[model samples]
Target: MKGRRITMPEPVHENPPEFLRNAAEPVRDHLLGAAPLPAFLHGADQLSLEDRRLLVDQALVLLEQNYVHLPLKTAMHAVNPVQRLRLLRRRMERQTPQTMPREWLFHAEMSEIFHSVRDLHTNYLLPDPFNDKIAFLPFLVESCTEGDRTRFLVTHVASGFSAPGFEPGVEITHWSGIPILDAVDLNAARFAGSNTAARRSRGVQSLTVRPLVIHLPPLEEWVTVSYIDLAGTARELRQSWQIVENLPSFVSADRDTAVSQGLDLDGDETQRAKVLLFAPRVVAQERAAEADESLPDLGAGEIATSMPKVFRARAVTTPSGTFGHIRIFTFNVSSPGTFVAEFVRLIRQLPQGGLIVDVRDNGGGHIHAAEFTLQTLTPRRIAPEPVQFVNTPLNLRICRRFQGGPGLDLGPWVPSMEQAVETGSVYSGAFPISPENGANAIGQQYFGPVVLITNARCYSATDIFAAGFQDHGIGPVLGTDENTGAGGANVWTHDLLSEFLADDPGTPYTPLPKGAGMRVSIRRTLRVGPNSGTPVEDLGVVPDELHRMTRRDLLEGNTDLLDHAGRLLQGLPPHAVTITEAAPADGALHLKLAAENVDRVDVYLDQRPRASVDLTGGQADLMVQGAASAHTAHLEGFEVGRLVASMTRDLS
Candidate 1:
């Protein structure tokens, strides 16, 4: 290999080409065969647009069929020469490599990427696989182009300076002895791909607004971490970024665990394992564990992570039996076993009547939370929808363990499954819910009935939980339209493909219109309900019953959904009540309450307890001295306190 300082010119737009932005000479040579590597890309400033095209034309010819993917190779011949040339031209127009040409990216489409194994461009790097990601850090920090006019918002760990004058969250104008924008922009330029997964990475759950990750490499004096801005816009700057707001830390962690697609299998995709961009899950995990040794506890242990007390176990007396009540705000800390343990305990303490699971504001967390809950609450085995990767060469290679080899039993792939694979555009089969998933579940099933409640806030994994309940007709769902649960199922992104846009040794990489490497839903989630084969990602989980929260419900904390659920579980009629002949004068309140199966009326004016009036024969005159205000009356005596028939009226 020719030794050269692989530097770029100033375009003052003078940046390393996208491929070189990620990879460098070594990777280029490995993929390009004996074709002479470009002499000096830094001199591109003097080259005219046509001159640049000539250079690209030559490179294209040299790479004609040498390193092309199987699908692309076939297409290259199938298409006419004019179309082929046009295709190549479009690639050049989109990919602005400061100097070198892209081998696997920019020009490469997502569909094209799937049917092809990554050449040396995105895969082969750093001599050591374990430390490959660690070696990639310097490119992100140091390789930005000097004098390029670009702006970036950089954040740091502590409230200290990341550079001498460059503080976190401040606009970095210069970096590493150069005007920083170009570097940030040049570095940022690589991630310009148009991937939908990246666009939809909003509402992602993290322990806090900013999730801090610090990595210390072995035998190295320096330590590195990924703070923010994998894409040009930092997450905080993005339009759809969300944090674990108003959620307990455990709940956030649980959802984070689920969203990151953490699995319970004996692998590194656990709560603590930190994987780097594009590295194989197995290797990145080992290095993360190794690097974790040097990290300070950083208050992780100091913070108590006990389960949040979300269950309100009260069994109200019903004609047949008692009805149980439980409210869930989120599945943040709802780990499969962790949540199941609490579920088992709460259900054990409840009366023999059916249960009401109030999931109003709960967005979801891990699927395992639902899985374990299913295992503990029901006797049926839970089966996850088949999650298959796209039919790309890299995916085919990665999924080979399931495709072939000694672990063939693990994969459900075979000749008979051809129709399913072809129809689904997927190469693998669904995953059977493993026993390890329900390790925390109680063996017995709950014979009592269940009632589910939801709203728009009942989203994501909560959608999964609701679907699971519907799968078994476990209960009636309330507080949502016919569209039912959140129409999103579990999604797995391709950070592997995403690595093409990351900062690496030879080339700093990214797709066009940069920023966004988050996961996409490769396999739509298949619901286990009667509508088998129908994905919840589209129609969502249909509800057995429907109800919605009114504006007053949101403002006044109405439990009408809960109330409706209780009545449904108890086979009782809807208790209707009305307030009329109302008058508020001289700080005195008087109202005629016409009701049925009523016991008494508890009135609260301006949220303060005011007075109570005992009812007789479902009628009472409520006269109480109070201020002129909006009053709420709880018209009760339906069954237990569980059944509260209430009404709201303004006494002005």
Candidate 2:
């Protein structure tokens, strides 16, 4: 035979190469079509075979596992060698995927599998693969980007002896040698598999770090600390920033890429702690020197600062003579007036000019923080905007839990509201009644102009705060087109599928998987806009002025943010009105109101309006209280909702 062409059947598996056949077997079974893990995991170490029979056995077992969310419809339509071979052959012809290393290749396949199971955006998928004991500071998720690759900027790095290459403010572009974007995507995708009871039954990575990168930021450098210190530090950071810490995500070096290289496997799987690979841009001394001048002034500053624990405020006098201020508040807040006292103290130090509230790299804490922040800056009375929740089946369940038991409430209207919960509507807004968001600051006041410097890293409460500033014509916004991260709901996390499983217990409990939990969007928040349903989720507060990060800006760290705010203050609108004092008389009250940008103030008793006083002079006294039947004061802005306030006296 001079020349001949020989044909051979392609292998049955398109993913994971032949070397990973053994390692990927359980995963394949759990996700795709395979038998019960216990059935084969027992003898898996010695069950290597090049024949299609092994794949067929695994597929048969998968069919029995009842992976409902998978592509397969029923056991009758079970997987077999013939079907898998055909699928693999078809896949191979369509795309000749890169022959990447075992790590990347396997991870890519797992990522796809995870997305196929559930939605990652709404679910928690971070996996902890490294240290069991660790701390966390909020890394800027919204600002994490370099083209398509996301880089996490360490506002503050977690303490303790971490892996090598650690520092504050160093932008992390990778995690454990894998790019951070890919790692986060993979980690998020895997946990998405735990959407429901059935999927969670087989879902191993949901809320797990193993087999996926759970830790959002890559490890920088190793440092030493005692567990006591670690515990306190972790709690301190978590409490301060309201951040969640992830366990390390790791795989032993032997099981990593060893098979392809024909290396002997290490028997000690748990002994070897993996390491983090830092980005060359941040870590390389030569690279830093090259871009020192261009990027030095960028947002890089004191990562580890003496700013309280999480909130910091200080007056900054840029080179210009104009007086300005910078305030960075990390935690959104737990209550409305939680930070009022601190905020007032911060503002009191600033000279009358634009105040820069730097909410860069801040993760959301509390929902009321936005209004609470604005209230401290403006003494005007503003309307309490209402938020509507989409009464989706899932949301209704969460609301009901929060709604609490109807067991033995004394309130007369409690049962009626409970009945409404029973007769749940599709959209909560459709109903005549919805909860009005309540937040008020009584004494704090700042009448000066404010410039909000935000990055894509700004978050939930930041979104609300930014939008309020613009909506109320408070001042100019710098650093972005709109606010960065949007707030969808007040996130309340529970262990595993507790939100769904506690009452129903959808599936029988197996071993509780490690480092897994759920962050559920319990209540939907609507922002102030033309549309009552306008959500901060995607349409974050678009800035009144764009301080966008340009290519050059990134190189130079956008040092001009505060400088721009200072410039805007040159033409800032002067104070419009003021609430001077309230004097009680008999069963009535007299209020002194000063108006320059004079419009009108709508007075109210117990949130119910009593009078609308149009300003006739620079100063006037208006009688607001009558008989003292109800003790409340309300001021409505000039036809607008801005400059409004609702005040009430404690009868007790």
Candidate 3:
């Protein structure tokens, strides 16, 4: 069997393309890793036009690879043709410091190529269902290049398409290709003039005025490309010098034209008008709202208004004085500063008796806010102890300076007083405690029993406040069974990767150009109780007293815990006094007690007996002195109840 002889196709043109002339040799040299290729091949006199051209083609291939690999839309957008070319050159030449060489012509050409390819692929190859026919025509028109020879391809493709209500002259428009005219400048004409007018008109106006349609290249018709291909192509083109140099100029020109024509590019006519006419009024309104004093400054009022239905807090005061008066301050988890100051003020104003601070639904805020509140409430000042050095390092040694006098010239060894330094400690000296200057201006003279009411809703800075109070002996936490634990303390930075360019449906790539975000912990706070030494890193502060309530108590509107607290404050025993007879008849429970010196007697069943009780007037007949002038009690069946007796003194 004879092998077929391969025939190599001859070059169509005797002279290579300009880019090929400038790029080929440099690209070949870079591939060979001979001498380092110039950062910019276009400017180097050593590289021929062919070398630069070859380099560009090679750079385009590398750019295509990068575009294919782009995972995020933002990165794809960033790697425009110009950038792609620069990156390719850098990679090939192993340029240090990774600096992109500036090239204006390459960037311009690449930008145009990127947009054209992207538009074609998005509209022609992958036409979205949501796209309108009008937009489709414009997209095709915008994608055409000046050098394209097969101009009839676009017209042929669009000929069969029919859009209802689109007419040839009144509504529809057309454009013809012309050198030096950008897509934006290619003015669309209404319709072709009659045959008589075609012969009559001549020069630029003839083509400009007549309905002219630029043909799409036949090569473009065969271009069956995907989004990835278009995106890569665009990125490569954007890396070129031509596109990058004109970006700022293009943006500025567009802006200037828009402003001059009074065009609202954002299309928000009403908003734009409002901004233009009443900007000062809007600013004034904002300022006035900010300065509002009647508004709830730092806590629930702000949060409730901002986040209406999510969470809310209302300051509750009891109508009856039985439970005394307690101010329930609720704050949002975001803004603890306002609440901290308010809390500090409240603690300072507390009388020398007893105080019940409620933090039932405080979600949390800044750690500093909580710490500051604690500092204000703390009665004792705990300063950082100075560290002593036995043998200091030579680098840390201090030099002594002394002033010499006539008689004291002999005494040259004057040792300087060493200031004490701080060593390892949980709390830093950022905000130190001082007796005169550092003390809370409101003062912390309250020497009273402090109680804090907390629930599961209490979290973050609120938990910190509770912990600080408990740790510093500022207060005793009362209830905290249903509170949310501290979480989401560390702040995270967002890494945005892509630019949203247009409202079109079929734009190919969306990139997250950057890497992973940074996580930061703003500050460290201390927890309450015996574990004060342990930092509240991931754990929340635990409540000192865990009080659980039953549904029955809630339904009955009975605050048993509050009542118990009241009892404690009033110096009353917890259990009721009781007395029961060992023997009983008629299934009735009765208790009786007598004392010569006592005025009243109270009795409790299934509990301890008390001598103090008040009975109106009916209980006197049931009592009589029997054995040793002591009041006797009637016997009854065992039952759980309290009985009280009141007596008057016999003055006779």
Backbone Cα, N, C clashes tallied per candidate? 38, 37, 68
Candidate 2 on 484-532: residue-level lDDT in tens? 5444333333333242336665433222233433233333446554445
> What TM-score does candidate 1 get on C-alpha atoms?
0.41
Q: How close is every model to the real structure, measured as TM-score?
A: 0.41, 0.51, 0.28
TM-score of 3: 0.28
Question: Which residue runs does candidate 1 get wrong by more than 4 Å?
Answer: 1-305, 309-322, 332-335, 379-390, 401-410, 413-427, 433-441, 485-488, 493-516, 572-652
Q: Cα lDDT of model 1 overall?
A: 0.39
RMSD of each: 20.9, 18.1, 30.8
| Model 3 stretches astray by more than 4 angstroms | 1-341, 344-352, 382-442, 445-447, 482-524, 528-530, 537-539, 552-558, 564-652
Give all candidates' CA lDDT scores: 0.39, 0.39, 0.28
Which sections of candidate 2 miss by over 4 Å? Answer: 1-307, 318-326, 332-336, 377-437, 441-444, 468-473, 481-483, 494-511, 520-525, 548-559, 576-592, 599-617, 621-652
Candidate 3: lDDT of 431? Answer: 17
